[model samples]
Every structure is written in structure tokens, then in C-alpha cells.
Target: MSNNTSNACINDSTNQINIIFVGMYSFISIVGLILNLIALVVFCNNGRTRSHTVVYMTHLAFADLLLILTLPMRIYYHLGFTGLHQWMCNILGLVLKANMYSSIFFLMFICFDRCLAVNFPMSAPVQKWRKKAWLVCIGIWLLTFGASVPIYLSKPSNQTQDKCFDSIPVFAIQPIVVLPTLFVGFGLPLVLMLICSWFLVRAVRRSTVAQTNLVDSSKISKMITTSLLVFLVSFLPYHATLLLLSLNRHNITCPMLDAHRYSLMVACVNTVLDPVAYYFTTDTFKKKVDMGAFRRMLPLNSQSSDLTRRGRVAEDS
Candidate 1:
């Protein structure tokens, strides 16, 4: 809780490490900004007809955007151009937790939704159900923001110090913050997602679903890939590193701290990936999002069945 990242910790870490951090954020911020904005446009293009998946995916993009929009503040603070205030540290802590947990929860829901869509293709998609789902999404926003507040209790004042220089503050380093969130934020959601993936996998195996036109075979494949792959890539490494970070809090060496920091950079990759991966039914996805070269790397919508598409997710009404 006391800024475990001592002055020696920071100085011992090479300048090359700092350069990599800045370089990664510089690229991610510029490209992630443009992609996420376009994603918002695609998700909200037709509010009247936006489906349940759209609702969940909208929140996902929105959460990442909150983090994306604020990256410059983080970058400047890290680069030592600005000594971040205690108040700003608290605020950024909230924003960081809010983005990570909310996105985690939303991804779990999206997986469940996709499962239901594929499983219950003909089951009536309750209009009221979609309406009520928005309440759950709102609750997730409130829950993540609210829950992150407690960890700040353990942080040192650092009121007169370079608050920003303590890069891995209570949020990442404290057992109180890292442990519970690792369980609830990443572990629980990941377990739930794995279950959802299991069901969806069985659904995908049923080649009969494709022949009847009961479901869009390609769509099912896209949802499964996006939900599982993104959830893992965005969260798994960071949380794993965070776990190590917490266990080794007292003995946090330079390399371990650097590894944890790198995990964060990897987490930011989701922003660039989300537009293509999250929006399965987006109308203007291909038209407006000029990601053809990038799209090849991401292989969304290409149905390679038998390994292709899940569940009675009521269609997006």
C-alpha cells in the first residue's frame, strides 16, 4: 500500500523500458482512438433497431473508449511532463478499474447472449427482455466504479510527491485490490465465459444447424471467436501478471514490475481488436472502418465450420 515502487525500483528499470512503454501507448492511443470511435458510430447507427448484442457491445466499446480517451493523461504523467496530483491519481485509478472490470463483465454477458441467440434461434426474443437488460448494464457500470473505491483506502497519501511516479500503485500492487478483483473481475467472469464457450462449442458442432438456414453459420463462428478469444487476450495476461504482482508485492523486482507493466500494454490491444471482433451485426463495419489490411490478421466472419459456431440466444429484436 505504501508506494512499493520505491525510487530505486524506478531508476533501476532501464530507460529502454520507459521508451517501450511510451512507444506502445503512442501507437495504441492513435489507432485505438480511431477504431473505437468508428465502433461507436456503427453500434449506435440505428438506435431503434439496435439489438441486445448491440446494447452489450456498445457498453464494451464505451468502457474501452473511456480508457482510450484518457491515455494521453497517463502517457504525459508517465513521461514526467506532469506530476499527477493525488486527486488525479484517485480519478485515474477509478477509470482504470472501471474500464477493465466493466469490459470483463460485458464480455461475459455477450457470450451468454450469443449462446442464447444460437441455441434458441426460434424462441421468442422478448422485447421487454432487451429493455430490462439495459438495467443490468447500468448496474455493471455502477458496480465496477463503486467497487474500485475501496482499494484507494490503502494507498499512501503521496499528496506532495510525484503520485504518478508510483506507477503500480495500490490498484495493481496491493493484495486488497489485486486479489479480490482477480477473483471476481477476472476469475469469476472467465469461469462463466468458459461455461458459455462449452455450450456454444456443442452448438457449433451440430452441422445440421448450418444446412437448415436456422442460424447464420458464419455469424455463430464470429461470435464464438470474438467472445472467447477477446476475453482471453484482453484480460488473461494482465490478471496473471497481476496475481504475480500481488504475491510478490513485498519483493517486487524490476523485471517483475516491468512484466506487469507490459501486461497492461497487452490489455490495451483489445481497443484495436474490438471493432472487428465485437460487432458481428454492425451495418457499417466494413464500409466505414477502413481495416482491410488489419482485418486479414483478425479473420472475423469467415466460417470454418465443424469447428464453426451455440445457444437459444433470442435474436436481437
Candidate 2:
């Protein structure tokens, strides 16, 4: 009787947690959809696609938009609406995971582009590759889809009683798939982002006056800092929890499970935060945003070159 009661209590607790999660997902889905849609429209207007950074950001917003679109089914599933066929689940799951990784890689690509602009400003390949950014975005989408195949194949055909968006048991799938995903999907990209950020900082410090003027140094600094923060605060915890859950073979304690749930939600919150990053980082996007309001909220150092020259002349006189 005691054992049965304990099990009942645990189930009730899990259900309540799922309810809260569903509510949060609904909110994020609505807000993320709107923000990303606006971002796409802004990026598409006025020939903004010509810039490499805008091209990457436009794709990133599209990926996030798709990810948000999957949330309604998830919300419904969590609210006890069942009877979904296995294939439907698999397709939804595949798209969700694929786009999640797609957003990660595209953000990494943006970082790499910025790093190149800062460190190799005069390089021919850097100048030449801007036109080919669309091709690179296409390759990223293909690679993301390819990586999702293992997930689709391994997912169970019947999960009527299973929790929505739950992780598959680690032993059920080939280690090859799981291990590579942990490394490539999260670890490798994270390392590359850190390296790019380090190089970008160094380049900014060594930049000449002309280079600094060409790209707003303050904006670059803000972009790199925000990107690193997003990776560290949002993505890192979620991946760590996933790694631990997988390593423990689905026998993790309740606290760890809760941590995993919360961390995953935090990671999803990145979809909304990304627009803020783009506004600060992308010159074209920044231009579209109301400068008066933006400056009032986050004022830039406004001492102009002419003002500095006048001050110097005053001192000399």
C-alpha cells in the first residue's frame, strides 16, 4: 500500500510539472513566433540579404520560427490530448531536433563570419565568400537533416503513454549516434564559438582607426558578449543535463530530472533572446530599429571625431 501511494504521489507531481511546462511552452511559442516573423520581414526588406550577417540571421530566424511552430502540438500533447500516431510523432520530433541544431550551427557561423571580418578584413576569400553565404546556409540545413536521421529511426513506434518530448533511453539506440551527437551537436560547436570569440576580441583590440570606423567596435563587443552569454547560460546547462541523463541510463534522480526540464526550457528561451542579439549585432537590422529609442535605452559613446579635434585644437591654442 505504501509503495503504491508513493508511486501515485510521484505521478501526480510529474503531471503537475508537465502542466506548468505546457503553459510556459505556450507563452514562448506565441512570443517567439511573432518576434522571429518580424525579424524575417525586417531582414527581407530593402535588399538586406546582400550582407552575409543578415543572410545568416535571416536563416536563423526562419529556423527558430519553425521550432516555435512545433510547440502547439507539444502543448496539446502535454495537456492530455493523445492518440497521435508514431509517424507523426517521429516527424515532429525530427523537425524540432533538426531545427534546434540548425539554429546552433547558424549562430556559430555568424560568429565565424564576425571573426573573419575582424581578423582577416583584407583577405580575398573573406570578401569573396559573402556572396556564397546562401550556399553555406543550404549546406547547414542538409547537414542538420542528415544528423536527424538516427533520431527518427531510433524513436519508438508507439509512445501513447510516454511523456511528450521525453528523451529516449540511452541503451535503446546505437552508441555511435548518441556519442557523436553529444560531441558534434553541442561540444564541437561550443569550442569553435569560444575560439572565434577569442580571436574577435584580439582583432578588435588591434584594429586600426579605419577598421574600427567600418564596423562599430561597440556593437561587435556587445554581439560577442551576448552570444557567449547565451551559449553559456542557456545551451550549456541543457546539454550538460542531457549528457548526465544519458550517461545514467535513464535512472536519474527526480532533482536531476527537474534540472533537465528547467534547463531545456531555458535553452528554448534563446529563440526569443536571439532577436535582441541581432538588433545589437547586425548593422542593417540595427538601422531598421528606431535609433532614437534604442539610443535612449542603451546610449553609445557619442563623442564625434569633430568634437575630439576641436577639443585638441582648444588645448593647443
Candidate 3:
């Protein structure tokens, strides 16, 4: 009777937490979807999308957008709408995991790209490769997709009413997969980002031009700082929770499980915050968005003349 009562209590607690998670995911889904969609339109329409930095950011926004697109099903599943087929659940879960990792890697790519640009401005090959950023982006997508396939295939079988994000039975291949994933997917990228940010900061401090242009220096610093903070704030907690869950799989604690769910929800906030990075770091995007807003507020003929006058004044200053 005591054992049964304990189990019942645990179930009730889990259900309550699941309800909270549903609310969190619903809020993140709505806000992240809207923000990423706007970011996609802005990045796609802007002429600056041709640049390597913008190219990486464009792909990053697309990845986040795709991830959030899967959130409605997740929210519904959490809210006890569990009539979904197991295959559909697996596919949706796989997409969420796949894009989450892809977003991390793409952000890493952006950091590395910026580091290269700042640290080696005159290298001919580095400059030439900027034009081939599309190739790099394609390669990253292919690599991320291939890495995700094993996890997708390893999806645990589930009952009809099972929560979509519930822990699955460990598969024989899961150890082989999870170990590398924990290290490679989370650890390595984090280390690389830190290294890149460190180098960027050091390079900026050393650059004479950075000293002359306080505004540019501030912008660059803000970009790197925000990127690092997002990675730390969003990805680190989730991955730390994942690591703990993986280690404690045999004797799972309810609090640890709740932590994992909450951390994952926190990571979703990255999608909403990424547009802020674009606004701070990308000059062309900032200029274009500003011009767009200005055009909307002014008459068509006055727009061109005003923009011309402002450009001349800026040059004079």
C-alpha cells in the first residue's frame, strides 16, 4: 500500500510538472515562431544576405524557424492529446533535437567566421572563401542531418497515451550514440565558441582601428558577448541536465527529470534572442531595417532625398 501510494504521488507530481511544461512550451512556441519568422523575412529580403556572416545567420534563423514549427505538436502532446502515432512522435522529437543541435553548430560557425575575419583580414583565401559560404552552410546541414539519423532510428517504442517527451528505454546502440553526442555535440562546440570569443576579444583589443572607432568596438564586443551569453544561458543548462539524466538513467530522480524539461524549455528562448544578435552585429541588416522603417514613415519622393542628404552628412562627419 505504501509503495502504491508513493508511485501515485510521483505520478501526480509528474503530471503537474508536465502541465507547467506545456505552458512554457506554448509560450515559447508562439513567441519564437513569430520572432524567427520576422528574422527570416528580414534576412532573406536584405541585400546583405550575400555576405558570409549574413549567410550563416540566414541559415541559423531558418534552422530555428524549423525547430519552432514542430513545437505545436509538442505542446499538444504534453497537454494530454496523446492520440498521435508513435512514428509521428518520433519524427517530431527527432526534428526538435536535430534543429536544436544544428542551431548550436550554425552559431558556432558564425563565431568561427567572425573570428577569422577579425584575426585575419588580409588573407586572400579567407576573403575568397567568403563567396563560398553557401557551400559551407550546405555541408553543415548535411552533417547535422546525418548525425541526427541514428538518434531518430533509435526512438523508443511508446504506448498511445504516453507523453511525447517521456524517457525511453535504453537501446543497445544508445550508449554508442549518446556518449559521442554528449561530448561532440555539446562539449566541443562550447569549447570552440569560447576560444573564438576569446580570440575575437584579444584581436579587437590589439587593433588600432578598434581604438579609433569606439562605436564599432562596442558593437563587436556586444555581438560576441550576446552570442556567448545565449549559448551559456540556453544551451549549457539543458546539456548539463541531459548529462545528468544520461548518467542517472538507471535510478532517475523526479527533480532531475523536471530540471531537464525546464532547461530544454529555456533553450528555446534562443530562437527569440537570435534576432537581437543580428541587429547588433550586422551593419547591413541594421542599415536596411532602418531604411525600411524610414521609408514607411516618409513619402516616397522625400525618402530618396532624405536618405541622400543623410548619406552626404555622414560622409562629411
Candidate 4:
């Protein structure tokens, strides 16, 4: 095929992929949002306030919820929103980018927290360090908000085929956006999680030797492993694409366009896969869903005192 013909074909193929992903992304975003919202509600109502796992889950839900909130703008972009109330378009793009990237930080923190808990059970302040956790959560949001501020303020407005709006300042774009996110979000998290999982496995292995040895907590380990896997798989491609696309300057070539579209779809998939992982990993969430319970059956102050005591006992032992 001639270069012109090949380019046209590539353009058409890219559009087709975008169309398919746009609709799928919207649907998945809606489902993820609902599931995360439900998990949030259950966490709040069930008086799981004392559980560190619950706290992490709550924050994760918050991150996923934000991602869902931004989906409409994405749908608009792909569906072609022109003259979309200037402010609306800007806000939409801003929110979409912010939430999209912020989710990575949340995932990173969760991995770090889990790793700490698993590897240093005694030192890892699970729930007693709730204040610290809150601070960390606040820090994560603030840092991400600052990092993604460009997406909101700098996104090119009046974007059309002929017109252009640079989503972020070219100079402001740095490895901070890609390298740190990749390292912290996927690289560091994956390594730490693997180490944590290894230690957890060893812990479980030792448990088998003692008569009173607790059966392996396969549930939590499985959940963490699954979460790490999904997070790494779904996000690596998107970030990698961004890194490569960053090299794309004034180029509308087939390969660049193909990667750009594919990355977008992968990011969308994360929105869907995230909630599924959350639901599977959290037993409290699962129980709530299975029991069709929205409200707390016990008192608001109720907690698994025995479990808390046992956790403390186990650590002491």
C-alpha cells in the first residue's frame, strides 16, 4: 500500500479501536464506580473502622470513585464533544487526568502498607497508626493533585482536528510523571509486594510446623497478590505508552497513534479491574455483598475485639 493509503488505513483502524474502547470504558467505569461506592458504604456502615485493611480499602474505593467521576469527560472526548461549554470541557479533562493518575498513587500506597504489615507485623502500625495513615492518604492526594494539576489547568481547550491544545506544558512534563509513577506505582510496589509475599509464605510455612499453627491466610495473600498483578499489568502499558508518546513531537504516524489508543483502553480497563479486585480481596466486602446487608447489624461501636486481641497476641507471640 502507498504511504498515504497506509496512513489512512492506520487512521481508520485507530478510530475503530477508540470507538470500541470508548463505549466499553464508559460501561466499565460505571460498574466500577458503583462497586467501589458500595464497598465504601459497607465499610462505613459495618463499623470496620478499626481494621487497617478496611481503611486501605476505603481509600482505594475513594480513588476508584474519583476515576469513575472523570469517565464522562473521556466519553465526551472520544464521542466528540465540541462547544461543550468551555469550562465543562476543561474541567472534564482535568478531572479525568487527575483521577486517572491519582489511582496509581493509591495503589502504590496500598502495596506499601500491605508490605509493611506483612513484613514487619510488630512494627507495622496497623490500626493504631490510623492518624498516620490518614496523613499518608492526605499526602498522596495532595501530591497527586499537584502532579496532575497540569491536566486540569494546561489542557488545550478548543481542541479539534485542526485546532490543538497541549494537555500539559512540554517543559513541565518530566520523568516525575513517568519514571516515579512507574517505579513507585509498579516497580517498587511489585518488588516490595513480592518480598512481602515471600515473607508471608515463610510465615505460613512455619505455621504448619506448630500444632496450634494458624492455617495459611491464603485469602489475604491471594488478594494482595492479585491486586499487585492486576495493577502492574493494567498500568504498565499505559505508562509505558505515555513515556514513548512523550517522544512523539509533531508526529501523527501510525505506530504512535496505535499506541496512544491502545494505552487509553488499557487505562480504562484498570478502572474496571480495580473494583473486581477490591471485591475479591476484601472478605468484609464480600460478606456484605453476599448477605445483602447495607446497614450494620451490630452497634456502631461494635468491632471484632477478639480478632484485634488475637492480632496483638499473635504479634506478641
User: Which candidate should be chosen as best, given TM-score against the real structure?
Assistant: 3
Sum up the clashes in candidate 3: 0
TM-score of each: 0.81, 0.81, 0.83, 0.74
After TM-score superposition, the amount by which residue 290's alpha carbon in candidate 1 deviates from its true location, in angstroms, is 8.4
TM-score of model 3 vs. true structure: 0.83
Clashing pairs in 3: none
Score residue 268 of candidate 2 by CA lDDT.
Answer: 79
What is the model-wide C-alpha lDDT for candidate 3? Answer: 0.68
After superposition, candidate 2 runs with Cα above 4 Å error: 1-19, 167-174, 209-211, 291-317
- Cα lDDT of candidate 2 equals 0.67
Candidate lDDT (C-alpha), each = 0.67, 0.67, 0.68, 0.57
Tens digits of per-residue lDDT for model 1, 1-317: 33445555655542323566677788778888887776777556535446777788788888988877767766775665544576776677678767878888887887777666655555565444545668879999989988877666656674444535346654555676677778888889889888877776777677455445455556666666676788788888988888887887777776776777778778887777776676534433443354332343345733221211122232242
Query: Which segments of model 1 are wrong by more than 4 Å?
Result: 1-5, 12-17, 124-131, 163-165, 171-176, 207-211, 280-284, 287-317
Clashing pairs in 2: none
Candidate 4, after superposition: displacement of residue 92 in Å? 2.5
Ranking by lDDT: 3, 2, 1, 4
Q: Return the clash pairs for model 4, or none.
A: 156-165
lDDT of 4 by residue, 1-317 (tens): 12353356334532232576577767877788777777777777656333555555677678778767766655655554333455564565455556666666666556556545544555535535633766777776777677667545654454333111112223223455556656654577567656656655565555432113222355555655677778778777776766665555334355655665566567767766876775555545565666644434546633332322323211211
